[model samples]
Target: MTLEETAILGCALQWPDESLPFLTEAGIRADTFSHEIPSAIFTAIATAWLAKAPGGFVGIATALGDRLDALGGAATLQTAIEGAAQPVTLPHYAEIVKEGHSKRRLALALKAAYKQLTTEPTGTVLAAIEAEISSIAAGRDKARIQSTREIVMSVLGNLNSRTDGSKMAGLSTGIVRLDEETGGIRKGGYWVIAGPTKGGKSALVRYIVRAVALDQAKPVLVFGLEMSSDDTVEAMLATEGKVSASRMRDGTMHEMDFPKLQAAANNLALAPIFFRDDVYDLAGIRSYVRQVKAIQPDLAVVVVDYLQLTEGAGSADRREQEIAIVSKALRRMAKDENLAVIALAQLNDDGELRECRAIGMDATVQVTIEMCEDEPGARLLRLRQRQGKTGVVVPVVFNGETFEWHPLAHEPEPASGKSFNRKRK
Candidate 1:
């Protein structure tokens, strides 16, 4: 093993509390070491550290357990400590390890890319290069294990830091009760919005987009699988301008409508939002998000305008199974990137999420939209949050003219012949 690798490993084996944190923060994983022997030693040290194993070479031995002989054993560990560098310059050694890993990765990638030059298509060769560079630039961090105590303490700290009137933990969902009950759409959350045909699925998402975009000025991204790019913009224009969508569609707006449209466009331009109406397949969606995240890391939320439209891998599976694969992928992406994703789903005639029950199974929060029984122009959003509450119906009225939603005072009571759609006081 290299002297730098031994020093780093020795530092970790000796002063795990001090050096392990740095090693983890510096993105040092077991594979970062060039040789398998050092890599095995490093892996054991990390396992012991996270499990709160005892200090010194004994701790490393304890972690390795029965498999100690498979590695260089306790005697080789002695060599590591005998050649140990002081913990003060651990950061420098860690940097060397990272640099060496990058160089190796780059050289290997270039060799493979060169081979592809003759055999593969131009696009395939460029893809290989781009993937490698992106990987190198990302410097993927191996996760540091967090104890339950640490997690609860973090929750406590977050709650304590909130201002007196801070109701939500993430972006506002535009409904007061929904925000208060579920703490809004959160980072690393996967939300499923399901509804029947013409049941305000698009309208609800548009309301959230508007709330996040123009209302809060947060960066938002929308993948309009079912909606055209021009249609998405046109709908936004009508909604923001408070112009009748039908009139806008029919091109029958009065002369004064031009100024309103212009003003709405001006207002929308203030919000940093992107639309990928052409992205349909899963690879395209993931690639676009990765590219955007590389440039704009603080991208708040991603909206998939109806999930059932997008094509995914595992295409040979049964239709329902394929959809389940897609749903799992969407959920995985949100968790991997620490991103919030809202995927709209179509409901069957029986008002259940169509094709894949996994869509609801994987969602952190699932909301189903149903039209109000008595109020023709309004819809009720029934929320079933995995970690929060269930059996909560949020009444919302749709203003078709401006393409907006207003919260109603209470849930509808159709049995009593009272369907209230009045705005909440």
Candidate 2:
């Protein structure tokens, strides 16, 4: 048995109540211990504690029952007692034990990756490795038991970090009024943008991608499930360059449109917008994010072009549960990765979400687009916001030809079709 694991187990049995919290908080479970005795002992002690049994030998044995007897019971208990350290050092020993566990898991992951390399795609293998390593790393961030003062102080610090409350509190959405109302797209936020077909949900995502990735120079990721990566980029070019989509689609662009397309492509070539339309499952999305995050740790946004198309953990017949799983995972991923996750959703003609309501329940902010005859264009309503004001309406003007959409107050006119590469032949 590793000394650290044995020592930590000893500490837990000695003062189970005091030590269990630290061990669990440090991400230590039975699996965390490599050795036989330590793992069993930790499990037994945990079982005993959960049953409200005493921390003493008899109580733990009663709680763990056959578990202890199967592991050489009293003799093992005595051995742990002899090796026991004080609860004061529990945290230190827990850290050491956690490190050992991570190393063990890392080795296993590498071996598995190696075995699969001959059969798996290179990117798949790499993504698995990346996700496994990231999981290990995340285990180190122990959840703290915070006092009210500590919680308040943390909130204040977050507020102060903004530097100026007069501006949007989070990453800017590039729409001024929306930012003022909803405080921009917050880090660790799960935002659901819902609309019927051709209501400009995808357009909004593209606008945000361009705003954050190009204008703000922040990294952005997009998963366009309905469109291929190349086609998505062409669509972006059409909107951003003021080139006609039909013309681009047919390779029939006029002479003047060439520079505009070239300029758009040039701007996009190096911009930190990573697009992948191949991913159709949540695991793939998670793996892709983990891989991208390694390089761009500051990646700010993730857009799932439409939610219903993505596969979740459930079976084909259980669509609702599957969507719930997908929705919850997206929200959790946003929190875990500290980025804004914008998941577009399909809406019915009556403006209800086409699929699961769990999408809205899991969202920090949920907005839907609808058209009103009295309104000049579409109306985007903030139906729900967990952290801010709701029922706010933003007037939207969308140019279907240009694929440009924005709140009326902050709408920038469509690109002027200006030619670039002056002084050329």
Candidate 3:
């Protein structure tokens, strides 16, 4: 028998009440004990304790009766008594047994998956394995409780590390006033960038990618579901080189733009901005994120161009249900991976989300972008913010030629018939 099994059994026989909490917390059951004697002894002890009977070694042995006699009766009891672990260390010993149990459970699950693989469809097998794994993780998290002091210390750590309240606590979007209002993009944040079709949502995300990855020298992953990877790259190149996307697309770039385009390409070559335009579902996105995180631990953010375009698991028949699943999965992924997720979404003129309202509710920050009726570019309105005020609209300047956007720089107009603020490019 392993020392852990022996320790747990000994504690259960001698100090049932003391070991109960650890056993309960660890979710250890009688079947978890490796040895038959230990398992039986633990079962008897637990039964006696639950029944309000005296649960000492003798009491447990009596309760066990012939089962103990078959295992050597008094001598077995004496051995367990002599080898009893310290009462103070019961929890530690329980953890050891719990870890072993977890490993055994995983092995069993793998075996079951392997058996099913021969007869089941690949997707079913994979889903079964994933479900089991998720269940294990969920069980652990459910059992683990964080104290208020620990949470407070975590909050304090975040607060103490930031010298400026107005600055972003996480990755900066590179817009000064917007950063001040939204406190910048943060890890575990679910941000929705909503706008009408072709209303500069992609341009905004491109700027965000440049700000977070290129300018700040961090890593970012983009899931460009709406466009091909090459098209995404070209758009970024135009934004970076300050060239016209149309000119680049038609191979009609001016002679003077060659050097600028080359420079932009070189900068992008060195930038740690990763892109994948082929992912069409949430599982694919999650798998890709895991792969990227494994290779690039410093990955700071994940941008998905238009959430409604992505599919969900196979069972979701309705679009809204599919979107709900995707939204929850994306949010869970952000928290699980500890990264900011900026997912682009589409909004109608009535200000309702295009596919699912769940995205609006699930998002940590909901921002709507619309073209300024009186101006040239778009205005970003904070529809909802978890940590800040909403309804704040910030003017944005979009360079049509470059497909880049930034805060509009307001310039004072001279006293005239039509006095107005104009944004200089």
TM-score per candidate? 0.64, 0.60, 0.61
Q: Which residue runs does candidate 1 get wrong by more than 4 Å?
A: 1-138, 141-153, 161-163, 413-425
Residue 18 in candidate 3, Cα distance off native in Å: 51
Clashing pairs in 3: none
**Which stretch of 10 consecutive residues in model 2 shows the poorest summed lDDT?**
416-425
Clash count per candidate: 0, 0, 0
- Candidate 1 residue-wise lDDT, 43-101, digit = tens: 77765554345768987787677778877778879988987878899988988988898
Q: Which is better, 2 or 3, measured by TM-score?
A: 3
Expressed as tens digits, the lDDT of each residue in 127-158 for candidate 3 is: 76777777666544223233466689988877
Q: How displaced is residue 119 in candidate 3, in Å?
A: 56
Candidate 3: regions farther than 4 A off:
1-151, 161-167, 409-425
Candidate 3 versus the native: TM-score? 0.61
Q: How well is each residue in 12-86 modelled by candidate 2, as lDDT tens digits?
A: 777876877656655677777887767777766765554344776666666667777777877777777778878
Candidate with the greatest lDDT versus the true structure: 1
Model 2 error, position 71 (Å): 55
